[model samples]
Target chain A: MLDSEVPQEGNSTLAGHKKAVYARGGDGKMHLVQSAGWEVEEIVTRQAVDDLLRMTEDARRRVEAGQTSALEYHMHRVRMDIPLLAQASGIWQWRIRRHFRPAVFARLSPRLLGRYAEAMGLTVDQLQKTE
Target chain B: MMAFQHSQASHCESGVMASMLRHHGLPLSEPMTFGLASALSFAYLPIVKINGLPLVGYRMPPKFIIKGLQKPLGLKMRFETFRQPAAGVARLNELLDAGQVVGLQTSVFWLPYLPADLRFHFNAHNVLAFGRDRASGDYLLSDPVAETPVSCAPADLQRARFAKGVLAPKGLLYYPVGKPQTPDWQKVLPAAIKKTTRIMLDAPLPIIGVRGIRRLAKAIERLDAKNDAARTKLFIGQVVRMQEEIGTGGGGFRFIYASFLQEAAELLARPALNELAEQLIDIGDEWREFALLTARQIRDRDPLAPAALADKLRLIAEREHGFFHALRRAA
Candidate 1:
């Protein structure tokens, strides 16, 4: 149940407005309800997103420093772990692990690269780039 | 394309279903659609991990709402999935050209219009595509989670539809093949309520329903005993995500279920149903409180301890167990 009074304006990451939620009304009917923004829930959601973004950033830094391949970085950016990435690309886990190395990833064929790219929802060129 | 009204809903799948039904001349509220589908449930599968965290689902798996509605209402539905992106887009455009509003299962992370913080790899987000803007080549999207209809570039929409991961959308598209006749509430409402109640109270597996809640509480206690702060935080955070973020209507779908009960009470002219609705609302408040406390613990950087948190969860489980038990008998 939501607060009986209309919620006051508060900061939100949503599209610059409050969203309606259904709540139990006095008449025992469900009514369109509003909130002052779920600040606590928003904070938790942002923290999770920040944790993900940090991982992607770390991956990007590694790729830029030539410590890892762009495929590895893009995998983090798309929020897929190694095993999950392996499954999605339909490549064996050991083979996918090997591709994380810059030299190994660079020597991969275009057809193989295309599979990785398609799995990541990117083009072969985009997959190769650090961004 | 047909002119379809876009209304905001607390959850995506139900909202999309409601909007799609309304477009086909069968108007249904989000809660009503959700309730009729008997979509509510609880599961805590430690073995099923998403992003390396255990899965905690407050409802049945994806497409259950659509499938659930199909059987009871006798709706003829056409479901399509594509192996190629181009074919999927072509098929979607064909449906739009025929003025049919289509329901799409898409990855939330791939939809660029959503706030970045809210974007995750949840692949079962539902939206309706009614038309396309010829000038800009954008698809008119009625994303139920959003406040208003938005347009998505064709490329972005394609990525969302074809995103690969667990529960991949695979460009799944569905539409009702014909108009749905209004259902007989007298016959359907009680049965739907009873079925949902039975599942919640009587599911045999310990990993699901009331037993599942107890199982989660025990797991939380075990996690606390391990004293791994980071792991505990991650586990609790996933629970919050499943409860609040993943279209559970702010309290693990408890409020939505209550809303359904209220509506059912009116339609069936049963005061007892109304009383049950109130009880469900109270249970929903308890769930909300638990979420808030857990959030506070995380935000305040308090050390993870099983005693306090587990106690809270146990109370919730106990209350829900009793409530659902009574609800099952009453229904």
Candidate 2:
């Protein structure tokens, strides 16, 4: 039977979050036991979040400098890669890459822009804005 | 509507499956549900990148739990994924009006109740929506990963359900379509165990199962001072993320599998499975040790050679390879 003592490492720390672990109860059935947060898990999650924010910040700078379109920035903000963005928007991979360019993105038809916007959960106007 | 009892689970898919089955009057523990589904596996795909790092998975892709349960247990389930968000929301409300608790696939990053640090682009997170308070526009959610039942704003839940990314939820929803017949554990248990063992031991691709572990170890071993520190750290971080953060239960689902084996031992009347379970636990501990060492190296900004890290990983790979091989023979 699995022990009730939760492993000290790599546990999540979301408020009131308990892990349903297995333990041998008095009835000899493997019952679910609740376990609290582990410090290691919290640290790993925090690090991942930090990495994502850093990527988003970099994308924001690129958009500000006119190196990429607002769509590209929003993609990074949502932790998406080019292929994933393309798949989600139902756009061809190469077409999505071209759309990353600000000039090309600006000239996209309303119908095309709508697909990208909806995929990102944003309006067309919001997709056009870097902020 | 069935009164859903929310139990925090170590992993999302298995937890949701267990809870849903129980509500339908099939009282299967999370590990039993996981084992019966044959949900455990390992894959390290170098070509598939997530966040600029190679993808490493400790379990099968999403929806396998739902799919795997069908034949063995004779469960009838309905699953749908929407192209239009509005239609998806309408369908969900329609189901709610009929007093059915619905299972939804959503992106973790878009779920408001998650800590900012725990939020990511993962879109395969599963939750059960039991009811909605019309006045507050908050849906009562039974998120297996959460400590307790939580309330989600309609807008927030909508965004989560339709979040765009790899493995996008696309407003996916599923539920039981009919009552499950009594399962034939005698037939189901052995079949599930054999399939899992075969998949882990005999996958054709080198990037899956025991081969994948070795492949990952070799990749880590190949890292050198020639590689930039940032690149090395990113790779290590991704491994850690796959192993620890992606809901593999503690120790990359090792403990959960051990629990399953312990249970299986009783069910099959095979005490040898209990011995194997303890061995699996030891392998899990080694994985934890590896994570701890890697984390320390990264945090301390230690200038240790990649060879040292590679050595540690190789040891883990060897142990895992041995354990799975023995498990195959024992089964």
Candidate 3:
């Protein structure tokens, strides 16, 4: 998980592995790297609502040593897997339903339409049928 | 005991009454759902009456499958009494040793909150516990979540991985083969039906409060007396809600129906109430048989979709409802 706190320059220098680095900013937009070992800066934190994308070397070491949950270490990977699994299950459930109910598409039309509208943060009635 | 008054009851109505007898009643009455389940299960496979009646799918997951076919013809499925944490691993080992226990569904058994130190990744569901590797000593299992079959060693299978719950041996839950063309099927059906009916009638109390039926009956009576059509409709909704709670949304329909009967304990006074009770009972009976047949068919076909089975039941319930309404007027 990314922490919001700005990285200390002294700490980055002490790690001894300084190299020009680039990162995606908190705004989900990419940023340019100017100097060696670019740490999460105050400007990034101010621009993004979410915490700055920074996992200090010390925290990384602790997690690698099995001191903390991989839940934090593999947060991004886990988050990516969840939506994929849900989508797969939904497709499978739909296929199975279709096998049993030949008209499953029509049968589930109302329910799916309502769900999708809600998901888009819109009401069901707002979905106009565009022939 | 005075014979239930039949001056107004006709032969057709009496037949309907027999088919619709009140299957469920009160807080502790026999669980109608179990009876329904047993009778239905008995339809497809000759269910060996281990306990009084057979109970299918009414219980929760990681359903235990015991070893060795006890009867030559009948199928026996059991539920283990207690649970242990290392159950998934242990059960996998036992089924491998048995050789006959194929097509298993694996799932995680733990709570949401877990300790940091004791973390293991083994919360898998619908995994088929099939073959095991001899040289590597790895268990060949089907991981439904992955939608593929795989092999995993004991270490790879962790106890703390899934939710936190002890997975112990329940009972042997295997479908037994019954005599293919036995004349005794007729004899067995009634025995299994009666036994299952009694068993279900005996098992529900906790979820459906003791006084649930009484309250429903009161509400129904008030609505009917006031001649308030809308309120009566609302009362029907309340009954449906109560049914859902007691039946676990039809999971425990028999028990819920029984509770309804209990609430209408004084139904002897009103012909209509008495008739409605009977109709519900018959519906439960048919549902039990239908559900079992569906479960059996699905079980026979590997990786059967339960949705298909549920659809079959919806059709059966719809038909039964028609006969039920016809009897309501006479009662």
Candidate 4:
């Protein structure tokens, strides 16, 4: 891409930061241009962030209705899912999913709760209850 | 102690490797390293899901570049990882004390210096640890994506290096084990160019290379969003995110590859490759256009937008198919 053609439209997703891109200069050689941001980039990034928010909201509703445990709500609230929480905590996915049942989660041992809390960077108290 | 010079580049892994190599007296441009590794390609693996979204990558998997450059360039270097965090940290400090800039694989999420919005659970992000600040005990790092070098606390660096997840680093540390040798550009460039085209054009599965782009287009068109609006948006978002985000440098690495092509042409004294580089630039522009269209569609929420998005991808697939075929011959 030509240096002049590079987009410099700033966006919020980049948090007022710029990144390097290789663009053609007047000398017909490649040079690094600090691009403010691109709207397309912002759109996709916001979509990801917003999708997280959507999941969090849905989890909140499910927890409120008692269809699932606080585990579901707090998981997305901390920006994690079954795979991430499992990986970070070294817990099995099926066990994590099993805990989604309110009864099973309520009866969970303190040891497992400690593991989840550590993985999510939350306290054991915070793990048991939703904010 | 030798000073480690820091330079910004379009991508992280290759940039980190380039800086580390340059510090070791093997001054290589980021594009040169990336091209020599033949790291560029397209893959859409529906089977591999992240956050419930399918995987879409514009390049080969992580570690491909730093490792891929080995055989072709005769870059004999030490690549080691520690099972224990203490051992890894100790070795890193030892290397830094010896004036070695060490390349590290760390999770982007734990790096506090990055803007919070850009921090995610990506575990394969690369950075260079040049030294440690005596006063603060923070590791001085050169994150190529950032405009300037930054510092990270020892604890935070450990946390990032040991972040447990998919593609966990396991404290990966690598540096040049032997002095680098200059490659014969005439022979190496042609081979690299041929390998890249083969990667783009040859894949057993439809979900790889040019075929992968076509599969992605078909998936977009097949998305049934009548009642699942949010999920539909997520799918589209996932597709665009892979190309735009994750430090692709622009047009999902097309621009970077084009730059490499331009350099390769001059290196190999192949004037025809210069024209091919321009051709690739045009193709990269189309990719940008595709991103623009997809983003606008997400905002507009038109019922028929998926078809439009798919049509754009189809065009990109055709263009890439033609470009790779021509590039193979031109190089």
**Candidates' TM-scores?**
0.93, 0.88, 0.27, 0.94
**Per-residue CA lDDT of candidate 2, range B232-254, in tens?**
76687678868877456767777
Q: What's model 2's lDDT at B72?
A: 78
lDDT of 1 by residue, B1-82 (tens): 4578898888888899999888888898899999999998999999988888899988888898888898667798889999
Candidate 3 regions with alpha-carbon error over 4 angstroms: A1-131, B1-98, B102-128, B133-138, B142-153, B156-184, B199-331
Better structure of 3 and 4 per lDDT? 4
- True contacts recovered per prediction: 0.48, 0.44, 0.00, 0.68
Point to the candidate with the largest DockQ. 4
Each model's backbone clash number: 0, 1, 51, 1
**How well is each residue in B245-305 modelled by candidate 4, as lDDT tens digits?**
8567888888888889889888888878878878887888888888887787788744536
**Compared to the true structure, candidate 2 yields what TM-score?**
0.88
Clashes of 4: 1
Per-residue alpha-carbon lDDT of model 3 for B1-331, expressed as tens digits? 1111111110111111111122101111122212222321111111312111121232222321112112211334332322443664566567567663333322222211222111112222323344667899866543322212456664533321222212321212222232212123333323433433433232253211212223223333344423543333332322222221111213224323333333333423444544544555445544444433432332243233333434444454354335333432332
**lDDT of model 2 at residue B246?**
43
Error of 4 at A107 (Å): 4.9
Model 4: per-residue Cα lDDT over A20-52, one tens digit each: 987888887766788888888888888888777
Candidate 2 reaches a DockQ of 0.41
| Chain A TM-scores, candidates in order | 0.83, 0.79, 0.20, 0.90
User: Who is ahead in TM-score, 1 or 2?
Assistant: 1
Clashing pairs in 4: B77-B177
